[model samples]
Target: MSVDRFCETMCIATIAVMFGCVACITIKTPVGAISGIQETLTVDGRPYRMSTFLGIPFAESTAGENRFKKPITKAPFLSTFDATKNPMACFPSHLGGEIKYGKYVNFSEDCLNLNVFVPHSFEKNVSLPVMIWIYGGSFVEGATAIFPGEGISAFGDVIVVTVSYRLGMFGFIQSADGKLPGNLGLWDQHLGIKWVHDNIQAFTGNPNDVTVFGESAGGASVIFQSLYPGNRGFFQRVIAQSGSALAYWAVHATPNAEPLIAKKGCERAPDPVKCLRALTPRQLQDDDTSAWQPVIDRDFLLASPQEIIFGNSSHTQNARNFFASLDLMTGANNFDGAVYFRDVWPFIFKTTDMNTFNLTRGQFTGIAIPSIIADAIKPKNHNIASIMGKLLDFEYTDWQLPNDSATLLFSLTNMSNDVGFFYPVVSTVKGHSSLRKGKTYLYELSAVPTTHTLQTPNWIQGSNHADDIQYVFGYPLYAGPRSTGNYTEEERRLARGMVTMWTNFAKSGDPNQPEDARRFTNATWAEYDLNSQSFLHFTNQGALPGSRFEARRMQLWLDLIPTIALMETPQAHGTGTVHVPEIIIGK
Candidate 1:
């Protein structure tokens, strides 16, 4: 039989068997009654039973008039809803590619749904901690089917819910006159959280004890959600991995939507939103315009995320206080920049083979470093950009081997790591820990996987972006035949340790507390503070506590660079050395 026929036959057979017996599990949520599938999964050579409910809608269809507007909460189900399979993914920014689980998802405009996974052990009156996952695709592309929560729910002993929101222009499009305020995607997430907080009890989850966690853009999205003034009590704790609201790529203050509107023949229309809505999703998604990202629309975001987090103005004090009230865990991979650099290499360096790309010092300072600063920082003025570029070139360069191609490659990779991932993540941690009201923990994943999923230059070592995801989700313990890669014994142990710690943090306010501390190499995760600058370092051998991660380099980006950028004027460039002043945090 063909693959489609085989799949259809197996699906019909499975349904027949389920109907023949009392195998299906039904739970009555606030919306209505829904049925899910119960399956047995093996983790660490032990069998566990869990129930999975997929494709549960949280909001109404976001097609036509609702395209660029806030999502309306999904009404109660008229009858029993069969939520056994994954929902169609939101219209992706790009066309034709498999998402996380090697599944080619169908696209739809009405794709605001969520999936719930519950362990059979805690499917009754017991109240278990809940974890809501948001996938990251730079706010342009992502699907709920990517990261399945079966392993997390079964092994971590917490109820897991993965949410799906709108993507690309359909999710974020704005007008100068505020006709289409951006961040409709964010509003969709807010409604999903609210739905869970209101109705998770049916799945034996504690709404009060909930943790919102995500990686990459999802990580940034969680941080953005925490900063939103209206989400004061939506979730109690947050975990952001390799992404931050302060990251330059995460937020676009003033995105130009006119090009896309004009491309769709809507420029002449008095109401661009309506005109664009009239076109099919394919018509809009096929345009060559840049992907739509989050913006400061005064509704979802009152101002810049950085300003709201660290600013001392009286108006921002309440936002800071609310942000500080929630427990936060944020961190980045050691070589997070390698993945980003690899993607942008051909465009900037004019080469795909980075290993053979011999870079010169002149080109490094003139073409390479300047391009990175301009792209990442998006400095307003030429003078500011020029000053920042010179400062970075001086800081990132290896004086001893300045002319070596390999050394230049390494330096460029580190520069990307710092300005993009490390600086933003550390800055967010600093702002949160500075308040001292909420418990905060930081980490760095340096453990290299034996089997590499992402291709990087041999010179670049350490964990790349999203490398920590598999271990966190316990992929090794439950990877099936169609899984991407196989895991060794060491990887299995690492997965166990990571899942234990991640779930522990969700249960209580601490990762090392409430038992299973010894599973994570028996290392106590120290709470991050300005004094020690402590963080948990995950290595190949085991988890170890470290202090002042890349102290000198961090000082360069956080303290020295900002200070120089502030003092240097247009005429100061190439004139003489500029004196850098001390910057006190929270002053």
Candidate 2:
């Protein structure tokens, strides 16, 4: 039977099963028949009917013996599966006092499901572009429930799929031996993408046209997925927002699995994986204090992301060539640094309120700068770390207003922004653009939301980390349960423009192509090159094209600091410690 006829028959069968009492849609996928629910979404004054297939298992449950191992593809179902309700989130790992997206409730190790949202207007013969979303919660906490794709799917005219993967110890735990190789989370994501590529055609999605996009750690995952030699044809384009694989926190050279294993009384076991598997999920999750991140397993990652993306060795060249084959779009927010200050100086500041926070010149010079340098740079040599810190202190200090607390706060925020978000994102674009193969576009989100959710200090001036997510997903038009506040008309227009640009990129390699989409902004987004460094600066007003975002700051971090660190030696500092200059408060 034809695909359209088959879909019609399946929908009829579903209606017959319910005695025509309920509205439902069913599609006969390669694996089995799945039933979905139809919903109405209103954009502007028009209501669009959307088909939502939720909680479809892409892979088998990673419980019991499957723990810490690569996810296996889920077997076919015997009967029509219900894809109406949201799936359970993977067990979340606790981050001490870190404000993440949602509370962990109704979680399980069997949470390897994905959700599909399609426009109801699409027929089975219509081939729509597919955009898969991978969420970010610092690789610890995130759920498909929090990120509803109905808005994007209905508005963008594309098939949207949100994927859920294993998290924390359940996903990234590794053994000292190779028995429990890490990166199970990445493997799960791979399987999810594969399942979508194979079965999306049944839902009127083009298998060959796919774009994978994500934020923060999810952004880093998009890069990693593109870097994998095996994923050449899995995706054609990638959009990484506010995250890069080269960031210090993105990949862990040495995973601290011993401490967690010892805490669980599995340190002395004959087989660590077996011992850990024997424990209950609660026992394993409650005591997992270690920061579980992706390790450089020889299979997934041959070397560090830095080595693969920046190194000139033959092996790295092959990886870079593969990465360059896909169209890339990446960037970060303007004030992304504000989020890291709580952890960077936990001793000095207990809260994000700058009015209550106090700092002296001595502390800023002697302690704060050094602490941030150590955290951001992670220099191998102690002398290099000290030198970089001293240089950064000199670069960031506002000499004219040395005693002003607001100035100090602004300076610190700038320093943190460069180290955490700006530098890494710029570096990623540079690496991709240098190859001169596939198209690369860069952007910086400078629009501060009027409706605030994060506890950003009043002194901070620009968008905080993850702030751009709302506009990208058209959240202003359709705010779900996690709505921060009511958005303004301007914000709604920005959301419409953002959705258009993002969907445009997914459909074609360029964000400006097909020029007939509702034009909210007159400014054209320029392609990023190494020399020009052109980027789109997103603001509440609209997108404005600019060149060399933070040109001076980029030079300081990318060129000057590294050069100084390389040239300086122990003798330069004398006594193995650099002496910090005293700055009187009144002076």
Candidate 3:
């Protein structure tokens, strides 16, 4: 039974015992607090109250004139607010699909409200660590209410906050005229963090111990926030899963390119906004315009993460402190590259049209591909076989494409992919090593596990994109889709190990607690350093000590300089560390 139901039963039993008659007792929350009609539940054996306040405005809804503009915080709300119902999602079709998932609910433009979960007996003085999650749908399609925990209040042990912000075009659109603003979604995160910082103490969470975490796009956002000048102290630590600074869809303008096509589709509409607003959510989904993403605003993203890490950018102000105060933990699922490489091969395969493919085959061969491979493999000190073995595995069967096809494709794909995903991660790990030596952790998901499903009895495979989400959020195993049959029994065990590691990290900067080893042999997690590059390797049994992943390949890729230059501000150089490119030539 849920905690609320259990509490109600006990309350009724208490009344019957005291009065010698069964009676209904009025259970109200503590005065002046965000109240819920729902009864409180016990957390760690302590009575904890929970509440969800729907539609507490965070910004002017991004509809009509407000479209493409930064969000404005709502004026203070008056009167008691009841958070009993699920609020509307941030303006529907932000992700271009209606009921994308059968359960995907639609929300609104004025969707600035947040859900607050607090334990009933939470004392004002006992400061709990806070975890703020930024849900990912490639920068779209997430609402504050849809996450697994039911509401922010469900996390009785720790103060958890989930935000509802604009997504896709409504959140991250940019106009060529420089008229349309970018990253409204990012601004919403800033506002949300600020809100938590100002008010979480009332919920018994420590603002100083805040750790921002997310999966996929949300993971990328956490990395982005780590490097954003305006975001310091808003969060002290970050946990990123799946999405990375090196991924192709992440760094290139491709995320926005599709919308240009959408703009073309919208150009013919009688009224752009009205047509977009009026179309059946499905029709808008068909328009293909919703892929808008966060771009460098010169204000929030002073430079792309590449320039910051390579220490090659000229712009400095508002950027110097980007990595100055961050403590980080990040990793990728084993098969993240599976779905990742599939998505980009077509671009490389159809490179004849620069308008469509962007880079020519020769450009890919002589410059782009080579540059990327060099950076990814860091071939200077290693042989081609050694570099390829660790960083990439080619197959002669279904996995291998004849001749140089696979090699070229892999290089092109991983080039941008590494920069977008791994590079930022490496940079973050390294930065923490230099700046916060005692407090950084990195992990790699290696195990796959079996799970039961309605259609099949058991299906399992290695970790794929977003696979780590359930573990990190402590969401129930049966909540969403199950894994494939190929996944090992050990993968499930690793998932539990991951949860403990994350919660432990959330409570304190260190990922391993004193008792972690009791649960699994790999309980001892070492802080990352350049020499050890220590990282927790997730396997069937649990996590184990690991280092040296594609070392030669990674080294080779570090030799070449990044082609795209970093954006510059006036005060300081935005570069945090020098990122040299290295390459590996596949034999």
- Output the number of the TM-score-best candidate: 1
Error of 1 at 365 (Å): 1.6
Clashing pairs in 1: none
What TM-score would candidate 2 get against the native?
0.90
Worst 10 residues of 2 by lDDT: 578-587
Across 1-587, the per-residue lDDT of candidate 1 in tens digits comes to 74434444454466566544324566678898777777677866788887788889999999977888899999998766777766778987656322442364677888999999888834457899999999887777878887878777788899999999988787877778788788999999999999999889999999999999999889999998998767777789999999988887787657557778877799899887788888888777753424477888877876677767766656566676788899999999999888865667666777788767788888789987877766665555788777788788888898998898788878988988987789889989998999888899999998878655567777767898878888888878886432455677777777788888899999998998686756656588999999999999887778899999888898887877676656543433332222222221100
Clashes of each: 0, 0, 67
| Candidate 3 deviation (Cα RMSD) | 9.0
Give the TM-score (vs. native) of candidate 1.
0.91
TM-score of each: 0.91, 0.90, 0.71
User: How do the candidates rank by lDDT, highest first?
Assistant: 1, 2, 3
Per-residue alpha-carbon lDDT of candidate 3 for residues 324-365, written as tens digits (9 for 90 to 100): 456678876655544433334444454332222333345544
Whole-model Cα lDDT per candidate? 0.79, 0.77, 0.55
lDDT of 2: 0.77
lDDT of 2 at 418: 84
Q: For candidate 2, lDDT tens digit of each residue in 106-198? A: 677899999999987444468989999998876777888778887778788899999999878877766667777888888988899999999
